[model samples]
Target: MRILKTRQYELVEAKDIPDPFPPYAILSHMWLSPKEEITYQDFKSRKEDIENDVYKQTGWAKLKRYCDRAARDGWDWAWMDTCCIDKTNPADTQEAINAMFRWYQNASICYAYLGDVDAYGSLEEAGLIDQDHPMNEDLDEMPGMIPVPGAATNHMRTAVGRSLVNAKWFTRGWTLQELLAPRYLVFMDKSWHRIGTRESWAAEINEASRIEPKHLTTFKPTDFTSCSIAMRMSWASSRYTTVEEDETYSLLGLFGISLPLIYGEGRWRAFDRLQRELIMVYTDDSIFAWKLSETNQGFIRLQRQGQKPGLGILAPSIREFRDASQIQSFGYYGHKFEMSNLGLKTNARRWKCHNDHTKLLIRLNCGPEPKAHTGIMLRYAGEVFERIMDSELHDTRNFERSRDWIGVQEKEGKDIIIRAGNFRGPLTGPSIFTLRHPDEITVGLKYFMDFNVPLMSRKLELLDEVSLLGRLQLQRNELLLQPNQLMFANIELQTGEHQSRWNVLININENGFPSVGMASQEDRGKQLGDPMSEAKRKYENLAEDFHDQAQSEGCLPLIVETKQGISVNVHLFPRPPRERSSETTRDGEVYIEMREYTLKIIGKEKKDLNGSKQPQSSS
Candidate 1:
């Protein structure tokens, strides 16, 4: 990233710049960029003139909206030359140009305002000024500088002058190199084309070409008539542009291919203008070969790597009106109707005749023989049938717009009925229809099954309509099937209402809880068929085994135990819950009685029978 050392210069204010004269109206407002810097000396030099210029200061309000939007967007910042950079000094201007490449590289995006597409003036018109001006005599017929009141005379002959004039195509607010180097460029007007203004001027070359044809020459003023005729003939097969072709051609070189016709029309002209005239398209991968017509004959030939050559006829012509329409046919005396092979000088089967209005006839070679067939025919039915449907899938009386359906007949043997929004009229050629949800989906389902019903020859239409139907149906289903929502399925019994093409229900012979067949040993071995009961039994047994292990691990009780006291035939019965709690709390203190008992004997066993305590503590 090369940057110029910042010079120790005074910062100049934007108000100080000299204003352009009244006759020279600004086509586009200026902007400043963060990439540039300004100085005091620069501002002071232009301050007096800029302050006096009423138009620059007064009309600034018009730019407020644009400035506000740009600021909000963040992608674009103001980069107007007048406001953004200090251009008063020659050193500053030179430094700015040198730093342009780095500046553009750093920018996220470039906004190229083409201004008004129609507001452009020709180079000749830009030079025009009134003969009655006070300094008219002092100024040359061409572009030149005249004396200013408080500032040095600004001349158009300088290198900077050339840049200012040529810059309108790219560099005015930006240098040409800077404009080209940006990461991305957005044209403000969607329709603004970088191609040259006139169909002829656009054809000029901005870059060099590699494989330029040997016999090619530049275009002259005389090639218009033949080119137009050629274009009308081939218009059906190819997409050609009448606007100048050179700019696109020049930009192509950035991709990496080279165009060779960087030389002049004749061998005698200087090479400098020649380099600027012819188009050179080079790309990173593919190389396209081009051949220009000799003697300014208004034609170009383009050929891709593996395809047959194509011809591009240029408008504006010279003499020797050759038929630019179709490639010349074969034979020595002139074979206008038949195709001749210029490369092989023999008859070729690939060539076929085509007419603008007539149905296209194509002939192909098949296995050493030629087979002929008539293609599908789709003709307009001359009337459009329209209808509208409601949410209930019933028809509603709506405005019927008619459009010609091509060879289509509805159930009534009339033109296929198409229902859309407010339009109900005859439609032919190309027409678009907009429809709401259910109708769109219903139509899509119908078309998906039998699109041939709408036309003699089928071509798919209504993709957006089909997509809308899907979205609408999904939304409806979502609403219908909400959580805990109740819905009814219309079910019919087999013997009653279920006998139809779509649904079937069967009744079993043996009923009453649906008998689970029990298999006997004889039935199992003798092929009578084992019962499902056998499988269920095995499953239950396995489940019990698993449950036992699980219960033991989980501290679950699987057995009950009873303990007996045996000394001298004394027996005690279990106490109830209330009695046990009372006994456990007999001491007037809270206590928990153990559900399981642990034995500890301290009294004599004989006391139980006697109902009194004997001397023996235990038996």
Candidate 2:
């Protein structure tokens, strides 16, 4: 480290100064244009020549004034970042970057210079008249000094306050640590006039930057770790650096961690590596709770296209940390966590979304009580990971008001596979659902297979007769349905004392799979000619019109069932298939076999006489 002799305005190495280091004040200011600011080589080559006219140039004049003030305060040495660290030497540059926070913390005092503010004029503009005012005529005043009357209010809305709040000093990444690390910080305007101290202007600073008051007024290195990771990152979110990578490098000292300086590795990669290192020691899940602003919703859409996986899992840039203030209210328990292939895995129970079978919810324990708060498990890279949706779980009703959850059951040795459809939420796109346990993490479709009387017999007979091709797979306690396959869902409905069973055939499309529904037995032919034939004809005509409109709009008409259990007339319209050469494509068009079946009732039992229903067949 290099220290400057205040009186001589010459730099001296700390080792050569004396046995004990001198108490020195540090200058904290924004860097000026390269041509105006003095560099290490420029100072070394023309030390005497530069010092002679240093007071004439604005940049150099501020340095001289800082040293003069430090000397007046009974300090022999002062440190200024501009010419103190040799930028030409990589080792010196890296060392200075890593040790900057500690240097500010250890300084006797810090002088924060705001070159844009005019202290005296701003005070007068704010109605705090100078000593020359009639009200202060009776009071004695020093020359070139502006004194405010004892009755004047502390209103800093004038030009000085605006300049102080909007100063370049507040926008730099390095200035953040400079402002917080110092024990005593004094704000001075352009003419070297005092504006206020850190304590006096802390509220203004907090309002301007959204930083907590405790951090600006009374900050310690330990406070960095004590605060949530997202909150810490928020401080630097709006700040920028000349070199992009320095944004992350500037924050190393705040977290008390260091990494080798790699300048060319863009800002995103630098911050990504920093976050990876942070998670190694930090145990807060809020670090992964970055919110996407309206501008970055494109990234979310891209995630749906499978063009970008894991991009939504982590924040794209540091600017997103602006939302970190909201995450602090979550009051999350500091649970130790590890990164799973899907997402983050912790010791938390998982539940499936009842409204949308594709969505999964993980119960996060916020406090000592087992009352768990829910967070959605988003899919990225074929794995389901958990992220806090709402900060405060005081009323889980905020999210639970629309959705529902079912407890997941894992077979003794087999992993639980939860097959859900595409997520229909606005924020999270289509995501796979998975449940993670202490011993293992499972990802796949697992459904409770409580087969009805007839379906159980069919499953046993099919197991012996036919090979389950890309259609279905039988597990110990669950069944997996493949895509583009039709399956029967049996549901039992009860109205008063009378019970009726209905069976519906559904086909899982290629877009979203892992579908589940319930069905049961029903005799449609017997209820066709009931007393409500006129109403039934009207309903059938509406269904036909809807089917015609769906074909015209190029959308598939969703199947709708009526409670009357009536067998409407069947109709079939065949569209000619276009022929194409196999050489035009590597994988030929998928030929889905169309099988038409008629439901036949025999002795109170209903069964398919032929095969499964097809899209072309209608009843």
Candidate 3:
């Protein structure tokens, strides 16, 4: 560490100071533009000439004045960030960054200079023109005369206060630790006038920075460990750094951990490394409890293919840790833990849905609590398995709590193992069993399916134009193609055995398949009758037509070409109603309701030109 001798205004190495180092003050301020701030080389070469040249630059002038003030206050030295460290040396830069918090904490006092604020001018202008004063009652009637408030008291709502709140000093990432680490920090305006101390300005600072009052008032290095990782991350959310990697590097001291600084490692990798180091030193599940936004889902999908070590279910960026209160609610207590390949293992009980198919509900062993029985919805896509919550499965707020699904407690264990299902059908290495915090995992599996299906279909359209064109021809022949020219399945429901056909408009849902009868048509509005029987007949006819068309074209009609030129089978099925009813309408008029038809794109399958089955693509 290097300290500046206040009397001489020259940089002095810490080693040069005797075994018993003298007390020193520290300058905490935002850096000036590169051209104006003095560097280490400039200070070294022009040590004597600096005093004369420094006055031209605001930053150097402030530093000189800060040193002079410290000297007059009985301090031997002062440290300013702009010229104190030899930034050209990598080792020095790294060490300084790691030790910055400690330096601030050890300082006799910290002078926070706000260059934008004019302390004297603002205080005088506001203090002399108080509208609430009794003298101001007839001030409008008098010319060039106004009531003035006393200048003896300090008010935060004055012009000086506004300048202090909006200062750039409060928005820098490095300044966050600086603000918290110092024992006594004095806010000084452009004229070097003292505005307030940390204690006197705590409330205003907290309001401006959105930091918790306790953190601003009584901060310590230990405070980092006492709070949830999400809360700590939230404090840095609105703060910024000049170098992208410094956003993570600057927080090392606050987190009480340090790793070699790799400047080029981008923000994503830097944050990932930071979280990895944090998890190694602290066992807090809330560290991984980050809220997912709509944009974050895309990142999760990108990483779903293959995740890195120590990154199990962790969000890629700090932006996800937005809510500090939500993270603190978990109250996870543990210091040492490890992540296992198997997560939250449980025995699944099969339950029937309206479709008559069984869905698995995995019973989780949540610690020793007897009444805390929780079940997560288990879904399987080939060998990959996923765990979802009950809240994510359906809109259950209006319905009674059923045995179908339940929420899991986050304090169960560090590494919870979840069994995929009963049949150990072809285990694909180690299955990824992930269970995110309930508040963080808002969107269910249906959301991802909804978001990706259309993209997949569009990609398929681009990749397999030939197959899409063939499908288009079939749609055109049936007049099922919309006016927009998009290919869709036609649902022709036959009623009354007279072969009366009602043309049901098809809609492409988030699932990427054409569905019909979800919305009643104006022409069919008055015809109110159950159309399940007619829908069943229409499905059978469509299935027959599909098979015959496949046979004639020497290619499966169900097989659609993907963007990668892979053939995927599309299945048409009837969607079960929320509640089944057999009662016909009072007038006995038959009508088709929307949402009757459902479509799904299954796994890829290849078929030869001769209609013989061929090998499918791995993807």
Candidate 4:
């Protein structure tokens, strides 16, 4: 039976230990951890003392004990810088350094305990740290300054200056030729020790196996060779190496790993890096191993169980991985950020427009903002108003409208009349429009009628003719309502020498409706008129039925069914901020200065014609 020695756990005077151990004890146990907590600030402040204590108090025996247990637990391979060889003792350090290649050749695995295990795991999960690659890839790679790996080797060797074998000491024995040996490079987080709970490591190990079974392993005595199972264990370092060697080795082995290889010029592509990383998942035919280079900067490689180890490759950056994912949830550092739903960027903007009285048309420049979609709002203001006038305002206030099949049958020789059907009145004229602001009224008429109009209607025809006027002639809806075209009509009335002419064109204002269009009411009597009352009435009835059914069934009403309830209002009576000031700006500027608006349709219970119903709030 193997005699496993246990240390005598006894509290001793700080002065009983060596010079560095005394101070180290004071800093690590006394100042840093005084019964309650360990403050990083205090630890950093006493870093020197901490280092001294680490060097003095940490002996080879402790490391050797851990190594023996680790081996017994079926961890055939181990790589603790302190226990792997002697460092403080120069002769032993050199001897271990020379035999590193051979040591790894014989060992089945290598485990690196980076002080902060949870942090290491997080960095790896986030793709911030890397391992299993040479520390430095190129000297001329960094543009402004020399590129250096974030962490150094046990010998304090800079990543750039260290030879390939020494730089990749963590993965030294892994060669393409020695493919038969099942080698693993494991990273044990040091943070696990400082953590108060015991379940962290166990949870991590279990979760890795559960979620990523291919990446994790648990040790058991029965499992060996191609089917060997092993659980990593702790041991003392003294048996593995001398006191002086363990002391010096501990310091050099403290850092993580990195790679600096450049695959392409400019920037690396995400897909390419992903493909590379995926390929590296397979090591040998029977076995495979993976390691994080540094915290998150290394690449992974897999070889056949009996293959010779190849040179280490650099790990791709996180940015590259995200790009490679091609998923909508993958966001970049700048420009487009990923949204939660589809990985696509949510930077896309939307603007909607509607006219309370008639058809709203808008024109925009094609320069800076690319033109994506164009829409016209044929509102139901007239029908809504009718409902209000009939004392049925409550019924229509929270009404939902649906899309009605619209047709524009042209009446030959008849001019497109703006005030048609229910909207005709004595005072109002056929609303004409022009892209330009009216300097003088050329054509005019009298009559104003309020009624709902179809999206494609005589109203739009009249608007097209009015806007084209003397400059351009338009015959069909397709010709006049092109994307990004503006429409407004010129109304002129001459009274002696001083002429009075105002443009009373269809409110083809901006990207949205004017506030008045969405306002509940101008006064008690006045209400917004709908354009397509017949269609709107039908749609509203259907929507009401659907809404009623949804309410009964406990379901939310689909907003799409609530057609023209969405309307844009442009208040002409209340002077706008731009118009309030007598400043002559560009026509585009004036349109932009006008208050834009929209209506959020709301749903309510269907009103019974005979039932006593509560008054509905106007919105």
* lDDT scores in order: 0.23, 0.53, 0.51, 0.24
Name the better of 1 and 3 by lDDT.
3
- Model 2 ranges with Cα > 4 A deviation: 54-57, 130-153, 156-160, 224-226, 310-312, 329-334, 340-344, 348-350, 362-377, 380-403, 407-619
Residue 556 lDDT in candidate 2 = 26
Predicted candidate 4 versus true structure: per-residue lDDT over 1-619, tens digit per residue:
0011212212222244334321110001001122232222323355565435442333332344444535544543333333223334555555544343344334444433333234333333445446653432221222211223453331211221222112122221212111111234333333211221112122332222221222223322122222211011001111121222222122111111112222222122322232233223311111101112221221112111112122222122212111111111111122121212211121211121222333321111111112221111222233210110110001111122213222222232121111111110111111111122122223343212111222233132223245543343322221122211223222333323644333222222112221111112111233222323433343233223332343344322122111212212122332223223311122100121323122122222234233454322223
Give the top-scoring candidate (lDDT). 2
Tell me the tens digit of each residue's lDDT in model 2 across 148-169.
4454543543345566777778
* Tens digits of lDDT, candidate 1, 75-126: 2234434444555555555544444444554455454444432211222244
Per-residue lDDT value at 527 in model 3: 31
Model 4, C-alpha of 425: deviation from truth (Å): 55
Please report, as a residue range, the 10-residue window in candidate 4 with the lowest summed lDDT. 23-32
Clash total of candidate 3: 16
Q: Runs in model 4 with CA error above 4 Å?
A: 1-204, 209-269, 272-619
- Whole-structure CA lDDT of model 2: 0.53
Of 3 and 4, the candidate ahead on lDDT is 3
